[model samples]
Target: MTPASEPATATSLPIGSDADLAWVRHQVRQFAAEIGFGLVQQTKLVTAASELARNTLLHGGGGQAKIIPLISGPARGLRLSFIDTGPGISDVELAMSDGYSTEGGLGLGLSGAQRLVDELTIDTEPGRGTVVTVVAWATGVPAPRPGSR
Candidate 1:
């Protein structure tokens, strides 16, 4: 099915509070499970969402994220979109490279997100905004993989 055909659940929030981020993270975990993603994939997706939320707060001057659920028959998945109005990435190629971080800390956000999911897409321009989308799926289940207790 076309990516747009996937059923989606989206929430938009300002980036001024930690509480907002936490809530979004929780929702992401719940949504991932509903979409039938594996545990490893769910963890990775949640982490990626965390990174995007932080980026919106710190870098994008606050933005929004749209989480979409992709059900590909026997393989269920999720599509995450993080969009920000802040200055976009000047060098996406460099940013994706390992060990490259614009922030003072290790820059594992984008790169690590890319590694965790099955598909990754990015659109950004200097002065405009940034949009990062990631998709991941369950490997062997009609339903979501069991979560770790």
Candidate 2:
């Protein structure tokens, strides 16, 4: 695994509906592409974002996705954090399993998302909410644009 660093830039988008999910995916795709991720890698990150965004809206009752561009020495990556304040996961292990879901989903959102990104972290509490973070690394990152995202 590559070493990590602070985000060079960041952006936050709300996850309130299907339209919001599409918007998140588009932003992620654009950023991932700009940062030098290959087509396959970009797709993986966007797919994971879509699934987590859906979870935020449908299950968590709405939230936001904090998108961050990270740098590790000369390499770079993108981190996406989906946060919500609604009911949290009761069983994290179960939630990561192959065929488990709380919302009658085909049960592939979280599990499949994990397989897509370079790093994944899910923080939750029974009563609080959930924050699902995913990071995708780039093979060759060009110089990023200056200024805030």
Candidate 3:
């Protein structure tokens, strides 16, 4: 059993190339499983990681991903933070809207990722970089909204 209301193990991985994206997804799945997330939970977390990792690589000029296991009382979950140092998003509001893509694709990266996770946060600075954090809690764990963590 994991420690209650205590910090668990965390992982950090570089997010540079396409290959790195695969590794991120794999590690995220593993982390989710380590915390006893069900198949659905693992799948969703992996999917969300994949999208954000891609954005970090393609849009942010590569970055790093930090995977952390969480335990708050009986609540357990996984938190993934994707950091990049490329050109930051100038308009986060427009960027987060559905069907908005800067690369001329389907434009569902950010919004789609938000739907797949329990909590999502975006911290970006124009010309500096971007950091996106997401958490997927195991069933029955009440996920905190942005700024509450």
Candidate 4:
């Protein structure tokens, strides 16, 4: 049986810096490039991370973000995850949908993030917290599994 073709991995970065959002974005871009991600894709992914990180700070009252290198399916890649223990999103599906936003938010919304990446996953509960994850490969490939990762 052919199990799968996973590739090499680099170190992951866990972040929590309210005043260092730009630095965080820079790190993501540089690391994504190191992981073989192209320039345009790197911009999208980094921008997505920036949005999520900003939400964590502005909406969630600050939290944590992590950049994880993903080595799977014969391609080099990286994963960015933003998590917060603050008041969770009330409506996940609605929030993820385009043109949906609460009164105070920027209204650019999570849809942009979803559009920027190859794969995206989100989990949230009203009072628990929110976790947003994005995965992208070196090439602009579609997400291999809908729910596996």
TM per candidate comes to: 0.82, 0.90, 0.89, 0.79
- By summed lDDT, which 10 consecutive residues of candidate 2 come out lowest? 140-149
Each candidate's number of clashing pairs is 1, 0, 0, 0
Candidates ranked by lDDT: 2, 3, 1, 4
lDDT of 3: 0.86
The predicted structure with the larger TM-score, 1 or 2, is 2
Residue pairs clashing in model 2 are none
lDDT of 3 by residue, 16-90 (tens): 888999999999998888878889989989999999999999999999999988876556888889999899999
Model 4 Cα lDDT, one tens digit per residue, 1-149: 12123434434444456556787798899888887787898899888988888877766767777777765554567777788887899978778777776657657658888888767888888788888877777786443443333
The lDDT per prediction is 0.74, 0.87, 0.86, 0.73
lDDT of 3 at 24: 95
Query: Per-residue lDDT for 17 in model 4?
Result: 65
Best by TM-score: 2
Candidate number achieving the greatest lDDT relative to the actual structure:
2
Worst 10 residues of 3 by lDDT: 1-10
Error of 4 at 91 (Å): 0.5
Pairs clashing within candidate 1: 36-144
lDDT of 2 at 48: 94
Comparison by lDDT, 1 against 2, better one: 2
